[model samples]
Target: MTFQDYFPIWNKLQTDQQDRIRSNLNFRTVKKGTILHNGDMDCTGLLLVKAGQLRAYILSDEGREITIYRLFDRDLCLFSASCIMRSIQFEVTIQAEKDTDLWVIPAEVYQDIMETSAPVANYTNELMASRFSEVMWLMEQVMWKSLDKRVAAFLLEEASIEGSSVLKITHEAIANHLGTHREVITRMLRYFQSEGMVRLSRGMVRLLDEDRLRQLQD
Candidate 1:
C-alpha cells in the first residue's frame, strides 16, 4: 500500500498536501531487533507499519525495559515523530520485534501539514490520546495487578498473538516485557509448571491448561 492508503485522513488532505506527504515518505525494511528510534534523541518521524511487528518501550534508570505498546500491520505510530509533540516529555524507543516493512514521514513535513490541515491535526491529537490511554492502562496494570496475574495475562496474550500454545520465548525476554527480573519469571514459571498450567524447557513454554491460566488471570 502507498502512503495514501496507510494514512487515515488521505481523502481529507488537499492535493498539494497529499503530494507533500508522498514526496517526504521514507520506505525501509528493517531486520528483527533493529532499533528504529532511540528514546527522545531521535525524531524518526511518523511510522506506518506495512507489515511485521514493532514495540514501543521505555528504559528505566537501572536499564530495565518495559513495553508500552506493540504495533502490527497497518498500525500508525505517532510517537515515533515525538519532536512534533512538544508536550510529550517522556522518551520512547521504537524497535522492530520482527522483520518489518514500514514508511516514515519526516517530522517537519508532518508537523507542517498538521499546522495547516485541521483533519491532520485532529487525527494526530486523537491518535496521541489513544496511545496515552494504552500507556495509562499499562501503568494501572503494574500498580494494581499481582505479578502472577500479570504473568498469566501476558502468556495468554502472547499465545493469542502467536496463535500457538507453545511459545518460543525466554524467561529473560518475558521478564523484560513484564518489567521484572529473570529469576522472578523463572520462579513463576516453575510454580506454573507445578500447577500443571505450563511445561517449560530451556527457552520454550508449552501451555498445558490455558483455561486455568485464563481463570488465574481473572
Candidate 2:
C-alpha cells in the first residue's frame, strides 16, 4: 500500500494541515543497496517509506551487525526515543533493501505537526509504542529462544507484512538481523531447505513447509 493509503491518520487531517505537510515533505527515489543514513549521525527528519523495504541495524564494538528493525512501505522512521531524549546521534543505520521511494518530513515539521495535530500526535505515540514492543520482544527471543525459533519468528513477521510466503531476502541480511555470522545463516538455511521447510536461492527464500518450520521452533 502507498504511504498515504496505509497511514490512515493522514486522512483525518484538514486540507490546510495536509497542505502544510505537503509543503515540507520531500520525495526521493533510491536505488537498491543505498545507505540512507548511518548510525551516530545527526537526526534530520522522519523517513516515511512509501515503497520498498529498509533495514535498520546497530554495529557492535566487535563489528557485528545486529538487526534492530525493518521499515517497510507505510512505515515512519525516527530516531530512537533514547537518542532523541539525550540529543545523541542515531543508534542505527538505515539502508534500502530494494529500489525505494520515500517521503521525508523534516524534524521541525514533524514536531510542529505533533504539537498542532492530535491525530499526528496519536500516530507518533502508537508508532513509538510498537517499536518499543518489538525491541523488547526481540531481546527476549535472542536470549531465550533457539536459532530456529528466531528464524521462524522473523519469517512469520516478514510474511505477515508482505502478505506472501515467498520472501526476497539475502542470507547476509538475515545474518545481520539475527546478529549472527553469514556462514552460520548459510548453513542454517541449507539445513532448512534440505528438510523441505524452505527453498533458498541466490537472494530469495520461499516457505515451502511453514508448519514444519514452526514445529522446528517448537
Candidate 3:
C-alpha cells in the first residue's frame, strides 16, 4: 500500500515532510507466534499492521495473561497512548498470531505527523475516542451484566470481527480474555453447545444460531 493509503495525513504534510516520513518508516514481517512487544518494555513507534492478526494482553498480578484486545489487518497496535505521548515504557504485550506485515514509525515522528497533518491528527483522535468508548462500555457490561450475557456478547463481537460464524479459538484463550476460569468457560460453552447456539468441534466453536444467543443474552 502507498504511504497515503496507510497514512491519510500524508497529504497534510509538506512535500519534504512527507518524504521524510516515508523515508523513516521501517517495514518488517513478524512470523506467527512472534512476540512484537512486551509489558514493561519501552514504548516506541506506532505499529501499523499491513496484514495478519495480533493479540494484545496484560499480565495480571496473579501471573495470568488477560487479553485486552485483538488487532486485525490494517489496524494499529496500541498499548498506552499516555505512555506513547510521554515516551515511557508500555504495560502491555503484543504478539503476532499470524505472519504479519507491519510499518513502524517512531513515536516522536508520529507526534510530528499529527502536528503537521490535520487529517492524520483527526484520525488519531478518532481512534483514541473509539477505544475509550469501548473500554467504558466494557466496564459497564462487566459491572452490570451477567457473565452469560458478557460471554454471549463477546462471542458475537468476536464473530463479527473475524467476519465469520466459526470461531477459531481455544477455551483457555477465551477464559483468559474474559478473566475467568477455564473450567467455567468450558462449562458455559457446553451449555451453549447443548442449547444449539454454538457447535463445538476440535479447537473451534462455530456460532450456529446467533438469534438464540442474543435471546439468551436478553
TM-score of each: 0.98, 0.80, 0.84
Tell me the tens digit of each residue's lDDT in model 1 across 111-195: 9999999999899889889999999999999999999999999999999999999999999999989898999999999999999
Where in model 3 is the C-alpha error above 4 Å?
A: 80-82, 87-90, 115-122
Instruction: List candidate 1 stretches off by more than 4 Å.
Output: none
Query: Model-by-model lDDT, in order?
Result: 0.93, 0.78, 0.77
User: Which candidate wins on TM-score?
Assistant: 1
Best by lDDT: 1
* TM-score ranking from best candidate downward: 1, 3, 2
Task: Tell me the tens digit of each residue's lDDT in model 3 across 113-175.
Answer: 678777777888788777567666656776889888878988998898889999999988788
Residue 179, candidate 3: C-alpha displacement in angstroms: 1.9
- Who is ahead in TM-score, 2 or 3? 3
Residues 78-188, candidate 2: write the lDDT tens digits.
752233434444377788877899887777766767778899888777877887787787788889998978887777767787799999888987888899888988888
Q: How many backbone clashes does candidate 3 have?
A: 0
**Clashing residue pairs, backbone N/CA/C < 3 A, model 1:** none
